[model samples]
Target: MNNSFGLTHIVQFFLFVALQVLLMDNLVLYSTGFCFIYVAFLLYLPLTINRVWLLILGFIVGFTVDIFYDTMGIHAAASVLLAFLRPHVLNLLTPRDGYDSSDAVNIHVMGTRWFLTYAFTLILFHHTAVFFLETINSQTFLYTLVKVLISTLFTGIVVIIMQLLFFSPKRERIDYR
Candidate 1:
C-alpha cells in the first residue's frame, strides 16, 4: 500500500476506535448491552490485502482498544484471530470465479445473505474468543455467555450500519505487468 493509503487506514482505525470507546462504550441499552463500532475496521478491509499486514493491523487495533478499556490483551488476541480467519471465511463465502477485482466486500456486491453470514461468523468468533479469555478462571459461565451474545449482536448491528453508511466501493484497476 502507498503511504497515503496507509495513513488513511490508520486514521480510519483511530476514528472507529474513538467512536467505539468514547461514544458507544457508554451508550448501553440494558445493563449488559454495548455496541462495538471498532469491529468495522476489521470488516471493511479489502479482500485482496496481505494476510500478514491484516493480522498486524488487527493486533494493533485491538490492543489500542484494550488500552482504552483496560482489558489487557484479550481484545488484541481476539482481533488477531479474527484477522487471521478473515481470508478463509471470505474464501468459503465467495466462489473462486467470483472474486471482485476491487477487493471490496459488501452486501451490494457479495449478496446480502452472504455478507450477513460472513459478518456474523467473524463477529461471533471475535466475541467468543474475547469473552472466553475474559472469563477463563471465572465461574460465571452463563453470565459470560449472555454478555458475549448481547455484545456480539450489538456490535454486529453497529458494524453493519457503519459499513452501509460510510463504506464505498473501491475502483478496480488493471495491472498490465
Candidate 2:
C-alpha cells in the first residue's frame, strides 16, 4: 500500500471512533442492543500489522472510547482483548492454504460466510468481556448475558451492513501499521 493508503487507515480509525461516540452511543434498542461499531476499525486493519502495534492501536481506540463514555477503561479492556485475540482467531479460520499478504478481511474479498464467521467470533468475545466487566454481580448474570448476546447479534448485523454498504472492492491491497 502507498503512504496515502496507510494514512487512510488512520483517518478511518478516527472516523470509527467519532461515529461510535457521536452516533452509536445514542443508538440503543429497547435498552439492550448496542452497536459498538468502533471495533470495525480494528477488524478491517491490514492483516500484516505488527502485533504490538495492533495492541497499541487497540488501546488507543478503547481509551478514546472510554473518554467519551466516561466508563473508565472497560472499552479499553475489551478493545485490547479483541486485538490480542484477533491473530488467534485469524489462525483458527485460516484456509488450508493460509492467507496471502494481500488478503483483505471483508465481505467483498473474504465472502459472506468467512466474513460472518470472523466478525461473529470477534464481536461475541468482545461483547462478552464488555458486559461481564461492566457488571460483576452474579445476580445480574442473566440480564448481562442477554445484553451481551443481543448486543453481539445487533452489532454483528450492523457491522455486516456497514461492510456491505461501505466496503467496496479495492483496486489494490491496503496496508497500514
Candidate 3:
C-alpha cells in the first residue's frame, strides 16, 4: 500500500474500533440486535489488498474488540472467517461487467442491491460464528439464532447508512494507449 492509503486505513481502523467499543457496544437493542459496525473497516478495504493481509487485518480488528468486550477469541474467530470468505464472496457476486481490481468495494461502486446482498451475507456469517462460539456450551440454539439474525440485520443497516452518508463514488478515467 502507498503511504496515503496506509495512513487512511490506519485512521479508519482506529475510528471504527473506537466507535464500536465506545458507542455501538453499549447500544444493544432489546438485548438482541447488537451492531458490530467495526466490520465495515474490513468490508470496505481496497480490492487490491491480498488475502493474507485481509486475514491479518481481520484478526487485528477482532482481537482489539475481544480485548474490550472480554469475549475471549470469538470475535477473532468470526472476523478471521469473514476475511477468509471475503474474496470468495466477491467472486460469487461479481457483476457481468466484472470489477476493476482497484475498485473500492462500496455501495457507490456496486449499487444498492449488490451492496445489500454482500453486506448482509457477510454480516450474517460473522455474527453467526460469533454467537455460536460465544454460546457453544449453552443449550440456547434458538435464542442464539435470534440474536444472530437480528444483529446481522441491524449491523447491515448501519453499514448501509454509513456507506450512503459518507462514501462517494470514485470516477476513474481510462487511458487507452
Candidate 4:
C-alpha cells in the first residue's frame, strides 16, 4: 500500500465484484447460507499492506457489491470491520517463523490448516455482521446465528476451493547437468 494499488489488484477487484454481484449473489442455499465470495479479494491482499489502505479497499469492495445488491452500505460496514480486524487475526495466527511481507494469504502459500482457520475466523465475523446488521432482532437471534454460521462455512469453503482450482503452487525446478 506504500505504492499505488497495482493493476493486478484493480483487475481482481473488478472480477471479484462482478463474480459476487452476478453469480454468488443468487447462490443462496436453503435461504440460510449466502456466499459472499468477494471477501477473498480483500483477504488475499499482501501481508504488509497498509491498514488504512486495507480499510479503503475493503469498503470499496463491499460498496461495489452494495451498488449491485441495492443494499445501503451494509456490506461496506461489514467489510470495514473485516479489514479492521484482519491484522489482529493474522498476528494471532502468525507462524513461528513469521510471514514474508510480500506473501498473499492463500492456501497456496499458507497451507490448508492455516488458510482454513484464518478464512473461517474472518468469515464468521464478517457474516455475523452482515446478517445481524441486516436484521437486528431478538426474535430471530437464533435463526440469524444459524445463518451466520452456515454462510461463514459456505463462504470459507468456496474461497479455499477457488484458490486451489485457480492458483498453482510454486514448484521447484531441478536442473541437471
Top candidate, metric TM-score:
2
* Lowest summed lDDT window (length 10), candidate 2: 168-177
Tell me the lDDT of model 4 at 141.
96
Name the runs in model 4 displaced over 4 angstroms. 1-5, 171-177
- Writing each residue's lDDT as its tens digit, candidate 1 over 1-177 gives 567667767888989999988898889877666676777788877788889999999999999999999999998999999999999998898776778565466656676787889998999889889888988957888887888889888888887776677655442332211
Model 4, residue 123: distance off in Å is 0.6
Question: What residue pairs are clashing in model 3?
Answer: none
Whole-model lDDT, candidate 2? 0.89
lDDT of 3 by residue, 1-177 (tens): 567778778999999999999999899999989999989999988766789999999999999999999999889999999999999998999989888765677787778899898889999999999999998857799999999999999999999999888886644321111
Ranking by TM-score: 2, 3, 4, 1
User: In the order shown, what is each candidate's alpha-carbon RMSD?
Assistant: 2.7, 1.8, 2.7, 4.4
Q: For candidate 3, what is the lDDT? A: 0.89
> Would you list the C-alpha lDDT of every candidate in the order shown?
0.81, 0.89, 0.89, 0.86
In model 1, the Cα lDDT at residue 25 comes to 82
Which lDDT value does model 1 have at 89?
Answer: 94
Which has the better TM-score: candidate 2, or candidate 3?
A: 2
What lDDT tens digits, residue by residue, belong to model 2 across residues 1-177? Answer: 578767888899989999999899999999999999999998988777889989999999999999999989999999999999999999898888888787777788777888899999999999999999999899999999999999999999989998878888763344442
